[model samples]
Target: MTAAATTHQHTNCLRCGRKLTSTKSTATGYGPTCTRKVKAAAKAEIVATYKPHLVAKAEELIEQGGIVALRGRNVFQVVASNGVDTYKAARQGCTCAAGLKGKHVCYHRIAAHILSLAA
Candidate 1:
């Protein structure tokens, strides 16, 4: 299904217990009505942790590697020396247990995504 369709079917904000519509509607991972609350929380957390350089790198990696193909197997068919490979989210989330527990992006995957974007 399309991302919009999938997001529409989503029941709850992944970041909060509020209800949600589509991922596009709730792009920040919060329900439409409570988006601000989620953003505040996220902002506070980001400020409390991680450096600016690390955050930049993670963003870069995501830009390059976030969108994986439907190949159904390899993270990337061909890996460049400067590129780092990562697994597609089996269920639209980080594979790391910690990430799942905290309901946040995993550091490893974030790092990879940031690096990819930088490249």
Candidate 2:
């Protein structure tokens, strides 16, 4: 077999580390069940962290011509009426005043979510 074909032979799911037998599972490095679990977990996390008011505010900001830029895989830079704000939606969270205070969700994070969904 060719080198590329040999390298593509994955034997286990990357997330669950379970043995893979199906053609699709080997090719993707994740079994169908594992993929569903991962996707569900991600969706649940987003739902858990979501704040309705913040999301609304973010939508308003976008409607007002705010710009959102991807700084990294999970980080985003949002330029709005207030100013430039950075938000890491994956782990670090938003660096805005509300986020830093640990009291409420920030509009920047919601904006980042909107941008991510659009992408």
Candidate 3:
């Protein structure tokens, strides 16, 4: 597999809010230093916060395109893995059984968190 970029365009860096005066910076919406920092932070944030299996499940939920935004407050409707049920998920909680347990971290919550970041 491969990925490629042929152009870049942004007026400001997304991370530090700096004016992007150079072409490369504008293209990435990040200055060189911030670009590296953002990548590292993104990779670290998820892994450090959740179990690896849960993270994989959350990513699977996203890849299945079963997430829907609602009410514009970092809330979402996430489909269950069984594909027969849906749950409302927020940053702090979810409606899934595991979420109801209060001691478990549900993938639905992780999916909502991931969606919030992309937003």
Candidate 4:
């Protein structure tokens, strides 16, 4: 019997399947061009996929500075409609009802994600 650690080698780009020659590319998995395209597509997806009204609401939330990133924490405080309650939104999940139930994508999570990308 033996205990050993195994290391996996990445020989191709995760994005385009191109052979990885550079150490930086191998470490990151995604090539330089794909990385840029991925970042651009993320912002575009935020605008294109979500409902127009929801996007507007999310933008308005950002404008009000309601989405605050907690220092040293990976969570953001999304201001509630009542202005009293707080919804803690993580990178892709939120504490709001909609987020919990997964019925619809709440504006709180969207606001948090938008702010995260901006930072």
Better of 1 and 2 by TM-score: 2
> Which candidate wins on TM-score?
3
Tens digit of per-residue lDDT, candidate 3, span 29-106? 557776565344435677789898988877666544456667673778886766668899987999989999989888
TM-score of each: 0.32, 0.44, 0.63, 0.59
Clashes of each: 14, 0, 1, 0
What lDDT tens digits, residue by residue, belong to model 1 across residues 1-119? 24542333335543334566565544443455444542343345543566665455443332223333233322322222234443443223454464467555554444433223222
By lDDT, who's the top model here?
3
> What is candidate 2's lDDT per residue for 1-119, written digit by digit as tens?
24453356568655445799998777655677765654454354455677666656765554333433455435655554434343444234676667678676677666556545443
Better of 2 and 3 by TM-score: 3
How well does candidate 4 score on lDDT at residue 43?
65
After superposing candidate 3, which stretches have Cα over 4 Å from the reference?
Answer: 1-42
Error of 1 at 71 (Å): 32
Q: Worst 10-residue stretch by lDDT in candidate 4?
A: 1-10
Q: For candidate 1, report its TM-score.
A: 0.32
lDDT of 4 by residue, 29-84 (tens): 54677556545544676777788788778766654445556743357777776666
